[model samples]
Target: MPLWFDSHCHFDFAEFDQNRQSEWQFARRVGVSGLLIPGVTHARNLQLEALCQQYSWSFALGLHPYFLAEHEQMHFEWLDVALESSLACAVGECGLDRVLAVDDAHWQQQLACFSTHIQLAKRHKLPLILHIRGCHDEAAAMLRRARFEYGGVVHAFSGSEQQGKAWLDLGFCLGIGGAMSHPGAQKLRRTIAALPKTAWLLETDAPDMKPAFWRGPANSPAAIPLLAAMLAQLQGAELNELSAQLERNRQSVLPASYLIREEPSIN
Candidate 1:
């Protein structure tokens, strides 16, 4: 079987609190060799770090825009300190979201938080684990203006062809998850299929973004193989090849000490 890496999964969430180890072990046994657990809030970093150490998975750190209202100016300061000392693989799952229910003030806070993460990423020489939605063009423009160079994953990306190209130009890999497997995401699927293999990575975004195969109550890392098979089918390539490229993409963007890097078997 092909080795796989879940480039994004919130394995630290409470949904897995009942049996995180067993679920993770199952995923590994089925060829999900590793996963990247992204940070959404400062309070969860310690718990996430402990889990990553125990399970030998990679992780990132940042405040998510989805919860911008809960964030304070001091959170950014705390993040800066943490990023300086923590062994985080990247600096974000943070970015702009035009579809938020927040008012203008919260939106501005989102922009500020994203900018801080960008600055932190640059300062630490770490890439970003982004969470952009409905504001790809604006975010891309901001990144350009900031001269951000370190690359990372664009989680659950569903942008237009031009927008996808913009993120690619900035050296980021677009994360392909259960959403991409949906038949209705015609434009997203078509745009992704056209991009080079290096531009894509696999994720389940668990305890969320359940694949089209089943509308399960919650997603999990174990769903990776299913998503991988779907991605290979969409890309019109062999499963083994897709597996190899996805691994390569992850290592390229988010290198962490815990991850045991192995050479890709694809030619």
Candidate 2:
């Protein structure tokens, strides 16, 4: 069986609280050797750290834009505390998202938060775990300005070919998840298929973007192989080759401490 990595997810969420261990067991059975869990909020940050400690998997911590309203200015203090204690693999789940709205005031706050995380990643010489939706251009521009020394993966990326290329130019890997497995996601599937193996990493974004087969049910890491098989078919590569490339892509963008580095057996 091919070893696989889930480059992004939220295993600390309530969806996994009930049967988290069982979920992990199924994921291992289905070839998911490891997962990268990115933090979304204050509550989830600590929870994610604990989860990582328990599973010995990798994780990242940051404030998500969707919950921007709930954050206080002083939250940065807590953020610092969390980062200090965290054995996280990276420094985000943080970035701009113009999908809903972002007035100048909130936008500036978001930038400050993002900048802090970028600095943290640099200080630790770790990769970043990002989330940029509907703000690719702005995010890219800002990233250019930030000029992160250690690049990372852009979680659940669904941008244009141009945007994808632009991010690739910056040395970031595009994360492809269950979202790309939907039959109706023609553009995403096509884009992912055409992307160079070096530019792609597999993720599930579990409990959120469930694959088509598990539409009504909660998404789990167990769905990784299902997504990977579809991706390999689309990319026109052998399953083992795709899996190896995916693992390589992940290790290249994420911190080495995230997983046990092992040689890819191409047999």
The digit string of per-residue lDDT tens for model 1 on 127-237 reads 998998888988889999999999888999888878888899999999988888777988878887888888898889999998888555789888989888878887898
Candidate 1 Cα lDDT to native: 0.83
lDDT of each: 0.83, 0.80
**Candidate 2 lDDT by residue in tens digits, 83-185:** 6666777777888776645487877877777787787777777777888888889888877887776888888999988899998998899988888867789
Candidate 2 lDDT trough over 10 residues, lowest sum: 258-267
- Give the Cα-based TM-score of candidate 1 against the true structure: 0.93
Name every residue pair that clashes in candidate 2. none
* Residue 31's lDDT in candidate 1: 75
Which segments of model 2 are wrong by more than 4 Å?
81-85, 102-104, 257-267
